[model samples]
Every structure is written in C-alpha cells, then in structure tokens.
Target: MDAKTFKVEDTKNGTDHMLPMSDVLHALFLQRHNDTGEEQYVFRREGKKGHLVDVRDSVKKVRDKSDLSFTVHDLRRSFITCAEGLDISPYTLKKLLNHKATGDVTSGYLVITAERLRAAMQQITDAILQHAEIEKTTLIQRDNL
Candidate 1:
C-alpha cells in the first residue's frame, strides 16, 4: 500500500514479497480493500481469519458465468505461458512467481529489480487482455509514464 506497491508480508513459503500492482489488479485490490480490508484475508470466509481454502465453488460460478471451462491452476499456467511468450527472462519470471532458483549459478548474482518485474507483469497482463479481447484501459499504471 506504499504509493502503488503492495506488500505481501507473509506467504506459505515463509518469505515476504513485494509487487507493484498493475493498473487492473490495482483497481481490483482497491475495490476489495474498500469492501473487506478489515478482514485478515482479502477473500476469506465469513468470520474466518484464514482465506477461503476451497474456492472451487466460487471458481465454478465464475466459470459458469464466463462460459469458460478451466480450473484455477489453468489461470496460473496461462499467465506463465503468456509471460514466456513475451520472451521475459526465466529468472525474472521465476522471481515474479517467487520460485527458488536452485541450480542456476548466474541467478545467485542477478538481482531482479522491481522495475523489471513490473514490466514483465505488465506484458503478461497486456497479453491476457488481448487474448480475452478486452480493451486496454488507462487504469493500469505504465512505467513509461
């Protein structure tokens, strides 16, 4: 929430991550924050501290509404594939996804910058929008600006 960035203080992997929110995600987060920022999790069950463990029902509802048959993991794979299509460096994409680089020697020296990750994320977002036939909106923050 610092300026245009969002901080993930803790994760299941026991690591904290910070990401600059793309405009579309920022708007979605803003709406969620306004609706339920008081809760511990953005999409938590009512009266629960933990997030909704099983979003299958909700995902099904969305899938039914959109008439798109896909599991939640499909969305993750689509994001990764689109980002890869842009020729985003594997290291950058891995960093964006919070994956540990174990065997790569150069990854030990390369520091992935927020700017680079933001650019990669934007590319992925743009690709998704294009694929979905959604018009690009000014809601997404651009680094060029």
Candidate 2:
C-alpha cells in the first residue's frame, strides 16, 4: 500500500496531525469503517451524527473488570517506555506522539522517513507482543526468556 494514513485534528496546539497507519492499525480501522459505513461517526450515541463525547466510563468499566490497574494515561506512559526500551530514535518517538520538538539545532535538519517510522512501529509492536507473551499463535514459553 502507498501511504495509508489516519488523521486527528484540533489538537491543544491548534494543529491538525496526520499519522501513517501500520498494517494492523489499518486492518482495525478498515473493520471499523465497514461496520459503521452508514453512520456519521464510528462510535456514536444512538441515532446521533456525532461520536460519544466521553469514553472514560467505558474505559473504567473494562479496567475494573480486569486485573490491570492503570488509567488510559498509564497506557500512554507504558507505550512510550516500551518504545524507548526498543531503542527507537527520540525524534521518531516524538513524531509518533505528535509532540513538538524542542529548540535543538539538529532537530530542524532531521527528515524522518516513513520506512524508518514503520520500522520503529514494528519494533514497538514486537516488543509489546513479547511483553504479553504472545507471538504468532503461541504464548512464548516464559522459560525461554
């Protein structure tokens, strides 16, 4: 595929950001699109044209049912920590998080490539899978680690 992407708009910084979607993300989004083909919003209220204004209660409900004790922000922190552990370049990570670069002279000259970003994303995915003891169809035998 040539440059598959999804975008988020109206950020706190007053900018629209577009991000390339990885294969798995693309698949998930495609599924959502298909499921909500006739709807104006993918996760809308009943008979509404817009999406739900808040998903915190839904997230909390699920969190309460699970053994994991983490807020949505915790997941964000975990993702960043895992990506850093995989040695992703700070620039790439910043871009992934849609964070503005600091006033570093070198950051101005850096042009991050899609291929490099994809590689970093894949590494992060692999790392997450490994952490969950999931690889392919089998749970990685913990003793092997």
Candidate 3:
C-alpha cells in the first residue's frame, strides 16, 4: 500500500485497484504501520494465506459484543448512500467504489485523479464523522494533507 492509497489485490471483479485513503484512514494506517513494522500485509494472520482472508468470525464477535447486526456489504451501502446524499459526482463515486463505467461514454472520457478522489474521500469521511457526532477539531484536518 502506498502512503495515500490502499491497494486491493483480490477485488470482486478479479481486478486489482488502488483506493485513496481518507485523512482518518491514512492516520490509522500510519499508526498501524508503526506498530506492526513493515509487513507485506496490513492485517496479517498465522494462517495459510499469511493474512486475514475471511472476517466473518471477527464480524460475528463484534456483533455479539455490540449487538449491532450488519454485514460488510451494509457498510458499503452506507458509504454509497452517504456519497449520494452529499451529491458527490457519479464518476467520483464510481471510482471510489472501483466500479467500471460499463459502456458509459462520458465516464470513459473522464479521468478522476487521486487528489480529487482524496478530497472527495475526506468530504465523505467528515460527513460520516459529523453524523456520528465526532468532534471535527479532534480529527486530522483536511488542509494538513
């Protein structure tokens, strides 16, 4: 993974993609990197794959503890809903979700940059944080990036 982007090797479409990290995510990743040292995978395990392949058990544990029932796809849906509610451009949202334009001529002509995606990501993050009542002052400011 790069400092600003996280690479997804096993995507649903079997194609790799790089996702720009939001400010909060970037900070969290940096902290994790510092604690774990340089490793091939961010979330490692002593398994055959040498990394976490399935998180169902972990999710179940969290659900058991917190009584919050949600699948990983729910989080993705929430993100899309949030981005739509914010009126984020469709192309940007598609890029963030790593979805192909799929015969959209205009989308084919568009080239969304990492910087633009980062800004959009930060906006989405800020919106989510705000909805969660997290204090803005406590977060890493977007200008700092």
Per-residue error (Å), model 1, residue 37? 5.2
Note the Cα lDDT for every prediction shown: 0.76, 0.71, 0.83
lDDT of 2 by residue, 1-145 (tens): 2466665666557787777766555555555666788775546665556776666876877788775677877877988999998888999998887789878888889999767777777778778877887653343232322
Query: How do the candidates rank by TM-score, highest first?
Result: 3, 1, 2
Q: Candidate 1's residue-wise lDDT over 69-128, tens digit each? A: 998679878888898889999999888877888988999999888888888887888788
lDDT of 3: 0.83
* TM-score of each predicted structure versus truth: 0.77, 0.77, 0.85
Superposed model 1: Cα runs more than 4 Å off: 7-16, 47-50, 136-145
| Residue 92 accuracy (lDDT) in model 1 | 92
Residue pairs whose backbone atoms clash in candidate 3: none
From the highest lDDT down, the ranking of the candidates is 3, 1, 2
- Residue-level error in angstroms, candidate 1, position 123: 1.4
Cα RMSD (angstroms) for every candidate in the order listed: 5.1, 5.6, 4.3
Error of 2 at 109 (Å): 0.9
Which predicted model would earn the best lDDT? 3
